[model samples]
Target: MRNNTGPYFIGNNTCMFSCWAPEKQKVTLRIVSPKERDIPMEKDDMGYFHVNVADIPPGAEYYFMLEGEKELLPDPASNFQPHGVHGASAVVNHHTFPWEDAAWKSIPLEDIVLYELHIGTFTEEGTFDAVIPRLDDLISTGINAIEIMPVAQFSGERNWGYDGVFLYAPHVTYGGPEGLKRLVNACHQKGIAVYLDVVYNHVGPEGNVLHRYAPYFTSRYKIPWGDAMNMDDRWADGVRDYISNNPLYWFEYYHIDGLRVDAIHTLYDSSAVSIWELINQKVKSLRETLGRPLYLIAESDLNSPRVTQQPIIGGMGFDAQWLDDFHHALYTLADSRGKRRYEDYGSMHQLAKAYTDGFVLSGEFVKFRKRRFGRSSAGVGGNHFVAFTQNHDQVGNRVKGERLSLLVDFERLKLVAGALFTAPYIPLLFMGEEYAEEAPFLFFCDHQNPELINATREGRKKEFADFRDEGEPADPFDRNTFLQCKLNWLARRQGRHAIMLRWYSELISLRKEHPALRSYNKDNIQAEVIEPGMLVIHRKSKDKNKVMVFLNFAEHDTTYRVPAGNVLWKKLIDSRDARWNTENIASAFLPSEITETNFVTVPAICIAIYTGAQ
Candidate 1:
């Protein structure tokens, strides 16, 4: 508790600064006070150095002085660096930041309608403070949780936040620690839970100095970025503890409600129960200790139910897992979309399967993998899965980074959104998706190394070889590409963008107001594949509240026979109200409401929500 990791009493200060520089000949404390003075450090038996100084306190600027040179070096384990990733570390006083959400409890994963946004691209300013003004938009739109892309310290000022090297530090360019505290506090004030994305698979390629200090990464297995963290080997306890503690730190320190673990499939673990089990165990313990809801959501392609099930039930006990099946299903259904991964989908059957059950590929043949894959979710709870139509991965990883709006018509896009929101699964919307932001979400990283940059470019080029005739694939390392990826706030105020924004707000309202709509029971869901181009989802509630969702994918009017159960039906929402109305929309619905009994007709490419008493 007394910062036992370091040892140091430096010049003119009582604060003891320390760093684990076991490989260095001589280590000094670089304090950015009167000047960048290099204070000599004393070594300990455990290969750590320390220097206690009287002048240093919270907000003091400093970095690990390697070899007595006062170079602008990043701290190997800095918690907050206000300058930059490669600059001096700033001391953050966690106690000093005011948190206003005392009565706040995290919304259950079952009730979470998540909006995943990259902070740098979410707003024009692209900083923590900049996101505060935009909270009303998300809160009003009905998002209960905002899943922020990674905030860890990476090399440059701007990044996707995935290529982070310093695990403990938040990015300086994004307003550092206090700024994040402010943003989280702002989010809590608006009743929106914050879920931070973390990368534990591998450290980013640049400014990674952890290997020089401790045995953080091992040679046992390699990941895309580098050697995976040794989670089941010697000194693995410390590594696990570091990651485990950081989640609670974000919760207890910054008041974040949850964490989205990035890419658990790449985490090489040889332990019997696996590394996921260990982390989920810790998550449960910490959540119990804090007397608040703490969620662990994993981004895994393994399709294993154990990733989200409770440990007591012979499972890992993670709160939720990202359901790629939902994304793929919607992606295929919305646009008849991509040729690359769309080979496995593009039918009403897959979308309907995803609506009723959680996954369509449960022990089924996956043409993408060219094999039978994915286990059945026999014991898995439907609430333990986060489903989405589009995420950063789907759009950003693509060659041109085109959203569904770029590929589909407005009617189909609305239908896709309605299906996702009304489905019996947790829903996530990518940033700018609420308003149908036309900007591309490109894969952009700021790498200092030329070889790394070239490799990234080459990787993108190779990935898009099938699309070579489509046009040139956008370079991933281009600065302009990243800048173009930023969200244009002006979109929300103009044209059909405002209408889409309202539609999202209305959908969120529907999801929150209707308990039947939020039910995660897989078997309780029923869908009628009325035709090849139209599907109707009947969400059955135990409370006797039945809601039927009609989706017409084709560009022509289709007639649907209302079930012969002697039920009186009411139209909840019709997408054609604004566009199809001859005079006023209100007058048009009144006549149809009185006459349309058991026979209802659906307009082309529109989704309508209907509730009835049977």
Candidate 2:
């Protein structure tokens, strides 16, 4: 089957247009460019309407007229929407751009330290080109992979990119296709990989004309936004092909290194050969052909190890998955009153279990869902799970969109960062977190439809009704709400922010330098709750190098006995030191040695790292 389903140039001046509309009896290619003409398309055996027209130049706009309708519709697989989603689709020659990353190969998944950022709020300009100048700063901070929020064309200029309509086109407001290519090429040139977030659960409600083209949606299952994609129903081949080929298109044309698929749990596919497996097969083939490592990370809520298991074992082959259990455990432990869905995770035991087992609710009863959730990930490697202290949903879904910097003190924030970086799994840091930016990442959008605008406003208010005491949520439709989310890049070198940035950079450097810190083998790591609000983790590498991390989450200074049998332990990092800040000086002048007969003093809400050989 021909995988190129969009408009492509056959020669210099001729363009070939193809679309899958099995239900439409007659389809017409309406050219609205240099000359206006309607040409009838011939149907192939595979329910595709295609035609090769002569004298059609690049950058010409066109649309598909279905069933003799006077009103035309944009192509379902538009490569570049020069206007918005409702506007005409423009023909773009894919081979026109000059790429410079000829020898660029993505780093391995285990070695990746992902930094997630939304393009609209990441910079003042909020364009792809704006991100290029900041690449050196991120590289200096030890970030090797940048997981960008979705750029797929949505209804308006500003959105989280979750409610995207056109999956193939980049948002024009963010400089469109060429802008994205430039960013990816620049990242590769600096030894950084780019991973784009993609939404495949359901299309956006506004300007989504997929249902009009073919049976792209099914009534059997409905998502929170709309009907689920028709991945396993009758006449679903074209829909499946379209959805699966999107990542390949990005990797081939845009040169993206990986994809972070949004909400894979909502993709209800009951086929014998699941859509995920098919996508994995295709990606595997592409990896061999391209001779580069490409990754597929799933944002899955289901704690099934099969999500990252190999395809030969009756599993959906994915490289890694977002592990929310660690975040919930850490959040609930840090702030007892800040419970949204963390009903079952307030104890230090849960945090310890999350560190060692990778999941807190592995076949355990979950009070929030009133059922036993998650299966055991006993044999799963830790690199297959990506853990984070904060991400887009954790901050944006809150009533006030408050970041960790606002919820906890600098000491506790450093403690959490210490735990995250030392844990077995791969670590991901949200943008502005390393330097502790105070800007809130609120949920904002610019929907043209009044109904959608009202629905979004009311939906956010009702979603956090229980947290009314935190104050009323900001109006998502307001322009100020979007502007408030932009990061203050100039604040990184200021007081306290500069200290936090140095601490984070040092932590990342330590994690990368020590093989024991980056080892993902759960069996080689051990975690134990030493006291009421203190936990100690021991990570061991194959070379017999051991690093121990002590975390204190209490309100006062405490002393814990060190388990250094015969080896002398040296202090690596202390969050409460005077160099980091002067506010917490309980352990500022404490001794760095850890003796078997003596106890070490740990300040309130602080973390200390020690290295020794076992």
Candidate 3:
């Protein structure tokens, strides 16, 4: 386990470098900068070659040369790659940062209002420091936690971060380790939790050199991004160690409150002890040692409760999983251009099912899967699921990468936001979603390999083969594709955008302040379809406080009977309220909360929230 974890140990201007190269007979440490030298590394019984070199200060660039190989390779566990992925790795001491978040107490997963943002497009400067001045804005929007996209070093400055080759190193372009540490410290100081997205299932094709040093990949299984990591293959102990240690590294060194583990279904670990089990145990132990909560949220495609279920019940003990089903059902039902996943969606019934039950396709026929998929998520607690109207994938994997705001009208946008906030689960807001930012989040990268670039273009073409009616997708290799995705923060103060932001802020306040709206207690929720394209959601707190959410997905106004017949209901929030949407000041919308209400008319694609204890 010694060499399976951190290989670089620096103290007193001396660094001990270790490389796992069992395939080579000799390994040499080659210092390229701050004076050049080549020192032979001694091999241990466990296939690890290590050497303790004096006068090798932190920030010095070095590389490893294998025996009989002419090319020098960067360390697989490099902490910083300042000169891109192919350049020599720089030594970084993590203790140099002055962290001021010792008294920072992170909230539980249920209370986390996660706002996911890519660091590059979040600000004009696109550095860690640039995101600091905007923290006050996020706080005002009621975002308590920010789940940053992967920041590990990738091939170039522009990437989704899933293509990162150096898992241990923070991207040099984003201010490197020091910049990330400062961001985390600042977030904790403002009582905000920082969650980092990490990719462990596969590595990027460009700038990837882990296979050169050790058995970091396996030929047994193929994943779309890159080779499947060698989780259960021969010599997989080191690979498991690598995957498990990454979370601890982020939590301990970077002061990250949680990790949004990306695409866990792609991991092929058939061993008795899977990588999930290994990482769960380690994080739990670390949680005890740190005396604070550490969230291990997974982004799994499988609707299996095993992701968040406890170990005793044959589950992975993760904190929660993203509920893509909720997004799929709601998107297809409301948006004009839905039905991408093909879970047999596009119905008000399915949206109601996603509200009452966690997954809409529980053992139901899926047109894409061509079989009955998923088990019932009936008794699962809402806190174990994270709900959203749109995420990075749902928006970016489109022909034009158009956001929901652009595809739907203003009322429908408010309806979608209402659906997400009222649900009994953790809510996540994609960056720019609060103000309905129409800028698309396109899939982009800056790989230097020509062959890889061609492959990427071809792959994107194949992905949207069925959706060619929308015109050809943006050229991902084009620099304009990356630049077009940057968020226009100034737009938040403008016309419709300002109104949407106010509506979202009101919904978030209602979700946090109202006891009936507390998340994760699914037993208090009851959703049913009242009419065609009309559904009513009834929620009650233990204190008898009640909230009724009326949604009309039809194109025209529709009438629906109230949850409690002939009873008085108080109007709490209306998407058409003069306070939020100024256009509805003198609108002719039906009064949903009458003193003796039986049924009331709701505008098309509108949402009205009523509260009262009958």
Q: How accurate locally is residue 548 in candidate 1, as Cα lDDT from 0 to 100?
A: 79
Candidate 1 per-residue C-alpha lDDT over 1-614 given as tens digits, one digit per residue, 9 for 90 to 100: 23434222233435666676555778867778545577888887656677667656666787675774545566666777665566667665566567788888877777778999998888878899999998887777788789999999898877888888877677888888888999999888888889999988888877776765568788888877668887887666556655655666677778889899999888777767666676677667777877898888889988877687666666666778898887787777667545356788778887787777676788888888989988877446578888888899988877789887787876677888898888877889999998888999988888888988898888888888888766777776777988898888888877778888888788888877776786777777787787768898878677877777888887677787776666666777877776422232432221134122456767787888877676
Q: Write the per-residue lDDT of candidate 2 for residues 423-494, one digit (tens) a residue.
A: 899899999999998999999888899988888888888988888888999998888999999999999998
Ranked candidates, highest TM-score first: 2, 3, 1
Go through the candidates in order and give each one's C-alpha lDDT: 0.76, 0.88, 0.86
Worst 10 residues of 2 by lDDT: 582-591
Q: What RMSD does model 2 have?
A: 1.5
lDDT of 2 at 322: 96
Q: Model 2, residue 399: what's the lDDT?
A: 80
lDDT of 1: 0.76
Candidates sorted by lDDT, best first: 2, 3, 1
Lowest lDDT sum, 10 consecutive residues, model 3, at 1-10
Q: Model 2, stretches more than 4 Å misplaced?
A: 1-4, 582-590
TM-scores of all candidate predictions against the true structure: 0.90, 0.98, 0.96
- TM-score-better candidate, 1 vs 2: 2
